[model samples]
Target: MKKITWLLLLVLLTATIHLPAQRKADRKTLENLQAHITYLASDKLEGRRTGSPGEELAAGYIAGQMKQAGLAPKGDNGYLQTFTVWEGRETGEASQLTINDASFAAGEQFVPLPFSAEKPAKGDVLPAVKEPDNIWLIDVQDMELNPHAPATDKYLEKAKEAAENHASGVIFFNGKEDIGAVRQWLREKPAPLSIPAVWVNRDVSRKLDGDNASGFRISMQVAFQQGKRTGTNVIGYIDNGAPNTIILGAHYDHLGYGEDHNSLAKGEKAIHNGADDNASGTAALLELGRMLKNGRFKNNNFILAAFSGEELGLFGSKYFTAHAPVDLERVNFMINMDMVGRLDAAKGLQVGGIGTSPSWTPLLRESAEDMQMHFDSSGVGPSDHTSFYRQQIPVLFLFTGTHADYHKPTDDADKINYDGELSVIKLVYRLIEKANKQDKLMFLPTKETQVSSARFTVTLGIMPDYTYSKGGVRVDGISDGKPAQKAGLAAGDVIMQLGKQPVSNLETYMQALAAFKKGDKTTVTVQRGTQQQTFNIQF
Candidate 1:
């Protein structure tokens, strides 16, 4: 009895000591997360939009943070992995629209559409007449061309109609009421039209087609230059001279002013400060980099990567995996954190890619005891992890579930659940800790997630390279046993056409997919390098 009292006291003392230490560690993690998210989601970063100056600033800051964490630069350019992204089209300085002798500004008054022909066009223009060998001027006054409630479907219809009517060129002019702003380029891939299509502003419209004016001979030079921006990925590594490396990643890019039109905001472009959307995950990634860089694991080297253009469809990750500095065969596995900030006790955290490896189920169960977790087996997702999984590397994506402010300007740093995020980060560290004890886990292919970026009834069983802005839906990876794979279409093949519909970009591809049912049979056309191939697909 005398010995038992002292033993109980010692046990109590040890428990008390550890409780405070745990709390202190948690406090530190929360503070660090807040600090990172506050700056990243601040207005100064301008939403950390991919390919913008804001992105560059965020990348530099992250790289600086990595350097502070004692991580050696492992990227192509120090800590920055740069990839080129197509930023739509910009009107050339020399491009102009001239109606007879009246000339107008290239981008201001008359803007050529993305598919507009780049050749000089000279023809007679009459607003009321549709004749062969004439540049037809169509009055969009009564048309459903409300720039606010943007409907560009009519533009293609008009272009097709004008082409069938044998018009040399097509000029669209607005009537009495202003039609908002005329954006020259559509963000997504647009099919090239046979004839030139130009939209003249309301001011230019009245000058060319006044109520009293007859027909006039028009000569116009249409030239558009492709816009490009360097997309950056921040990479830091802990080289322990291990046989394999473990990759931890998160995407740091958010929509800037909703310019790409992926925002849920009703009207007027606002800076989409994606704090919960990804600032949370990125902050967690930075903290992990700091915690794990000490080489305590002793099993595998660590690669901490913050990717950009994930919101634009995993652009940075695809490029990074394609041009990895290390051997792809030696990559152990990848862990991706997308939106792990908004963790709610009631809502819980989402843990995906459990099925990618047999090791995940037991280990995730061991690590996920602190909170409610929804586990998914498939490695493919809507985030950067899919890029790794597509390369046949094991992957996991941690998410805190989406909120009302998702993809909106309202997703600010003030809304992040700091304590909850800390818990999530701890859980991830625990998972990695457990992983470090074992040898490099074997990779296993899992079933593809039905939750596609394109929410259509049918699937082509292909992952689209969202950043491929050139033309068509570029196939990044073909799903196993899917229509694309079964049809002999492989990765890097550009889906130029699906059935009778022409697939230009993701939007067109989705639209074309939506038109078909599961049992429908169609001819799939793909651009494979220099040669074009067509295959029969039943989907």
Candidate 2:
């Protein structure tokens, strides 16, 4: 019986195995890239929004492509690395606001701000004063009084001032003439602020400042529901019998129905078909996978990844790094392709994170024959590559620069430059082959991408490296004509202290920034190498 079982197992294994000659790769061509982008950016997918059905559909398509390319599944479940995402929700119908003896209806007399804290809290309704725990009234007349000054700037200034004064909440008084504007704002989603705020109509505002008002208790019940969404990151691998591994990634998600505010074509509601934004990158990734599967590369394994939720703050890539299928220590480097569809033969390509590895420049130069290449040393940028960079892995980000159709409904498949994308794919393929033949690329630390949700009325106009994880926030880039530049602060300066607060990371820096109002002067201490430099900045 044992001999018979062994014989049966051997027969099954032999039957399943295919000869090398029998395994063939499909031809990689411009037509393939065009077809992939056309389907991904089609109107039927509804913009492939993160946490939406459209994104799930895109993920499924990518997994199918990888399977067809003879690539093994490298994800936790087959070819999908599924995860959850929490999104902001609309106000519930039971939510209401009551001030003084009269009860005001929501969406009529008043509406809560987007970033307002949601909780059941009651406090004494005091007049608009420059003190804590008071519902400050900001008249809309004062906000829009100067049309030339810009209403948004003025409102932000006033809000910042009120926040600095420790006002618990703000009640924007929308007069009869400006009620329409308030209504529009109520419909729009606002970023969550440090404090709760609301918009009250003229009738409600009159009651707050009326002579009959005695003691008042302001009550608000705003609740937010925590939701879980399942998203996938299509992952596959090309085994080359090498210890070192290389990662090639692209995101497949985009804004859905213009809800994320990334849409360039505002006002009119339409599908934000992200053909150039990411479908182009994804197509390049697919084509590369097909090319690599042909066994043309010399050494080093390859990881082909199509990530979802990049539009929603790089959630998919971040999740993959945390739960990677392969050992991160063996990774040679990461190459990311994002927005590579609209490459102009004359304009060339903008390659960021070139400074990440010392070998990248020489390798790129050696491979370039008729390509125009521009490079940036900063390893930190807005893309999936940043996730790998944050993990202390060297990365290269390829982009063709932004266009008028970026993040807009007009970003359709028909607008993609197929030949341009094909050229980029070919260049990358050659670079990969070169990299595979060499030793594992050295990983070097570069400036990190500073990202935060904290709001500020004033800025130092300097970009901080959030992934530094050191004692101080390192300045990576400084905007010209900004306060930091005027104060003589330069990149590579580590901010040890902001005003009186010790800066540790991006969050602490934001907290320190909130302490200073516009026009306030403070001393900034920066660690420039072994020396601690101090400069006075006015914000």
Candidate 3:
């Protein structure tokens, strides 16, 4: 009896000691998640803008983390999926026009609109004719100086009408006072046409008012180019001998300069350190990769990808979908992590893409129930998952939601909710485990889908695949918008036909667009829920 009692006591002690260690291990995982967030969100990365050296540095750091996590190279030559982009610039050269004998300099008198294939007018000589429908050349100063100066909207309206009427180009004479402002505006706004638009100083316009001014004419030219600049995507994978793959992605790029609204700072100043914007997401992906690599959960193949150039309009994700390392069809599902570090502790977590796949709701529901996690289940919206959704792949996007500091310089690492992020990571792991145990891949239909963007429009929200050779856009998701809400278009509706045209692709859809202007209505037909439907859209 004494020996048996001693053995029992030993077992009790072991249980007591092991319980705390298990808790400690869980705590350490959470700590590591926070550490990764802090380092990646630091200012040292300089925002990780596309094509910048800072971005390269961030990529290198991420690749190192993946390597340390025991992930194998799933990208070209080790870890980078490279591509190119076209960068644009402006040439500061004055364009002048001579109408009859009247001549104008660049900023002093006129501006040219873009998409003008050639200069519309050239040479000298002509007289004023006030025919109601006849084209007439007039100076900018002449219009501005008039007692009843028309509003800008009115001017554009008249211009559009004039263009429709095939009127000759307008000659704008620059006033000395507003010359600087005019030049600045012209430099920023794309020209309306290649029509012979010219800028002449007040003195020059006055000089041309002399006798024999009939020698007036107009001339102009523009110079530009399209070239390639290199960019890259980092991909890492862990194979668990599963038939289907699970993809986790995040874009590692931010706006390079403070020009657009998405820029982190005001004015043309400050480095856009996109810490919470995405470094947070990328960091989470790294940590998740580490956990999966070390954990005993075995089954589905895991692909972790850090994409470049998302700021320039989801370019990286789009590229990845088009040229995937693995068979895209074999991808069981995709989970996109963007801006996950800044969870609003007060509100808990707001999860999107819950309705994207039938499996998403059930899987997430089970995990949340088991863990008692605080989660809000909204549907998918903008971000990289739209690209995969276009390919008919099921996707779930993870985000903490937008904040006051979003896209601002204040969005630094210090502001992240490390504890909240820990909770989210734990939840994600549970969901992955649940997904891997499923009997078969879930193939959800594209109908009545929900999207956060589009101002809650009840129409089929289909994101077009720009890379598709077919003219019309490849449908990504049909949001629970009007037509889609009523007719039922889900997350994988591919629009192949609209009205009478064979929208065999996106290009054809554009060609069909030329048939209708804003306010004009048309019937749009699309393939969704494995059925064809024609819906009328009033644009």
Candidate 4:
């Protein structure tokens, strides 16, 4: 048995010595890349939105392709790793409101607020008045609200103030103008309150306008149902019976109808077919999987991954890293391709994470024949590769740079440069083959991507969950010796207030950080579960 194992290794090593030329980068490969991108970026796929049916179709296609390519399933469930995108909340159709013996529909005439408590309420609705345990009718004559203190002006805050006034329920309506904008925000998923709340439309508002002094009997039920969707990551493995494994990954998800507010397109809604944004990378991944399936490079195993929910803050990759299919220690390094379709000889192909390992530059320089390559030292960037880098694994991220079509409906499949993308896939294959004979790549940490984007001198040293849609930024990580860590900030702490400014999202957090200079002191307020805690800290 020992002799047989050594002989097999010798055969594999001998094949390495012979250095069989990798599959030729030719017309067939370019055609294959074009076909994959065209299908993935088609209108039928609906831009491959994460957790949507369109994304499910793309996942199935990729899985089938992997099966046909003869790669074994390395995921938890047959070449697919599924994870929850979000557990949002929405008002059920059963929710209704009635006043003065008149019925109002749940969606058309009236709608329940997202944060409202799901409870039935029966009481007399009085206009412009607040009393103990009775519904108060607020006339939609725009209340003079402080712009700077929007937290106090929001519906949730007003509901809390009404609770303090001992109101059983609150009903809002517009008397002076249309409340269409107000009704548009009737979404669930926020933190619910103890009292039920509903907003009445123009028709209902006109009926309730006569009763400044008269009392109207009200009956209401606000039912909120949880909404969830599962996002799948397609994984394919080439088992060479080697010790360490190499990961080549790209995210396949893109904006569908620009619903997430990340789209740069304005006007009427249209599908943000991210052909160059991600279909390019995903197609490249498929081609690379096929290229490596042959018994050419056998020193290390390979995992080809097409991630989902990348546009939604790298959720798919993060989940994959947390619940890795193989022992993380056996992983060699990760190579990520994203938006690599628009390569220009003049601008060059951008190659980041060069500083992740000492051998990366030398290997990259040796591998390049006539390709124009650009480099960055940071191992962390705005891509799926950043997830592996965070796990202490060396990583490389490839891109062709952003264009006018970025994050917009104009980014259609026809706009993709198939030849440029084929070159990228070929480059990734060469890199992997070059490192097949060497030992596992050594990992070295470098400055994060935000260092170049967010320019602030003061350090809070907290990692906020950029994907968090809930009210304020939630702490996902805390760095040692930073202001937040020293001030008792912990992971899961939702930062509500930063000094004098309110920290809402990543943008607001950066804005709040801009006010403070080095050595400045301020108070930071965070929501720790049911409790809101404040801490004093120095920059």
- Identify the candidate with maximal lDDT: 1
Better of 1 and 2 by TM-score: 1
Clashing pairs in 2: 115-192, 115-193, 519-539
Q: Model 4 has how many clashing residue pairs?
A: 0
Candidate 4 wrong stretches, greater than 4 Å: 1-25, 87-95, 98-115, 123-134, 139-141, 145-166, 174-194, 199-218, 223-227, 451-459, 466-497, 500-520, 525-539
Please give, for residues 108-203, the per-residue lDDT of candidate 2 as tens digits: 677665446665546786554445766567776656556433244455566667767877766666544344344333322334556666667778
> Which lDDT values do the candidates have, in the order given?
0.84, 0.77, 0.63, 0.81
Task: Name every residue pair that clashes in candidate 4.
Answer: none
TM-score of each model, paired residue for residue: 0.87, 0.66, 0.67, 0.80
lDDT tens digits, residues 1-539, model 1?
A: 97999999999999999999889977887888999999999999898888888998899989999999999898989999999877567676768787768888887777776667776778876668878877888877657675532256677678788888888888887733222234524444565777888888878877876877777878877777787777999999999999999999999999988876778898777899899888988999999999898538878889999999888778899899999978878999999999998888987888889888899988888888868888888888799999888888989989989889999999999899898988888898999999999988889988876556454778889877777877788887777888988999998999999998877777677778887778999999999999999999998
Candidate 4: Cα lDDT at 277: 81
Ranking by TM-score: 1, 4, 3, 2
Worst 10 residues of 2 by lDDT: 19-28
- The number of the candidate with the highest TM-score is 1
Q: How close is candidate 4 to the true structure, as a TM-score?
A: 0.80
1-539 per-residue lDDT for model 3 (tens digits): 99999999999999999999978967876677667656665667676777777778878888898998899999886988887764332223544555445555543454443222234444333555423333345544455443332133234444554556665554444434334333322322233552433334566667555565655444545332332356789999999887778898987777554433455445445666667778778877887899899877677788999988777656788888889998998898888888887777666566656555777877887777433434333334557876777677877777787878777777777787777777777778888989888854565644433333322223234545443332234565444544433444444456666656556543345545545444555677766565777777764
The whole-model C-alpha lDDT of candidate 3 against the native structure comes to 0.63
